[model samples]
Target: MRIAFLLALLAGGVYYTYVAFIDLNFLTRTGRLGPGFFPRSVGVMIVLLTIWALVDALKEGREAATNAGLWRDVAMLMVLAIIYAVALRVFGGFVATVLYLAVTLSVLNRGRPLQNALLSILVPVAVYLLFDRVLNASMPPGLIDILPI
Candidate 1:
C-alpha cells in the first residue's frame, strides 16, 4: 500500500513537472525569474522526494501496509484540494485560500477551532501582503477585484 501510494505521488509529481515546463509563460527577463520558476522548482523537488520516498519504502518491505491507517484522511484531503482548484478562479486567491486554509486546519487540528479560525483569517492576509506588497507578485483577484486586494 505504501509503495502504491508513493508511486501515485511520484506519477502526480511527474505530471506537474511536465505541466510546469510546458504551460506557464516566460516573463521577459528582468531581475526576477519567470512565472514558471517557482512551479518548476517545486515540481522538481516533489519528483525527487517522491522517488526517494518510494525507493526507501520499497527497501523497507511490505510491513508498512499493515501499520498504516485507513485512507480516509488522505481521501478527504484530496477532495479538498480538488475543490480548492475549482474555487480558485471563481473566488480568487484570497477567498479561495482562506476557505481552503480554514477547512484544512479544521481537519488537521480537529480540537482547536479557535486556532483554525484565526489562522484561516491571518495566514491568507499575511500571504497576500507579502506577495502583493513586498514581492510585487499579482494574485488572481477574481470577481470583486477592487475590494480586499
Candidate 2:
C-alpha cells in the first residue's frame, strides 16, 4: 500500500510538472521575472521530492498501511471549509464565522457542547472586534448586514 501510494503520488507529481511546463509562457516577460519561473521551479521540486519518496517506499519492506481513523474528520473539515467560504458571502464575516466556529467546535468536542458553544460565539466576537476596531480594517458587509453593531 505504501509503495502504491508513493507511486500514485509520483505519477501525480509528474503530471503536474508536465502541465506546469506546458502552461509556462517564456515569451511574456514581467518586470521582475518571467511568468514560468515560479511554476517551473515548484513543479521541478515536486517531481524530485516525489521521486525520492517513491525510491524510499520501494526500498522498504512490503507492509500493509494501517487505515487512519481521522480521514472522515478530515473530509468533513474540507467540506466545512467550502461551506464556510460560501457562508461568509451570504451571512457576513461575523455571522458566518460564528456559525463555522460553532459547528467546527461542536464537531471536534462532541462531549462538551456547552464549552464549544461559548468558545464559538466568543471567538468570533473577539476577532470581529479586533479587526474592526483595533485594525480598522473593513470587513465585507455580506448579505442583509445583520451585524451592524
Q: How many residue pairs clash in each candidate?
A: 0, 0
For this target, which candidate reaches the highest TM-score against the unseen true structure?
Answer: 2
TM-score of predicted structure 2: 0.62
| lDDT comparing candidate 1 with the true structure | 0.85
lDDT of 2: 0.82
Q: TM per model?
A: 0.53, 0.62
User: What residue pairs are clashing in model 1?
Assistant: none
88-141, model 2: which lDDT tens digit per residue? 899888899989999888887899988998998899889988999999986656
lDDT of 2 at 8: 82
Per-residue CA lDDT of model 1 for 1-149, tens digit only, reads: 67888889999999999998999744536746788888899999999999998889878886634323447777788999999887787788888899899989988899999999999999989999999989999877676453566
**Which portions of model 1 show Cα errors greater than 4 Å?**
1-70, 144-147
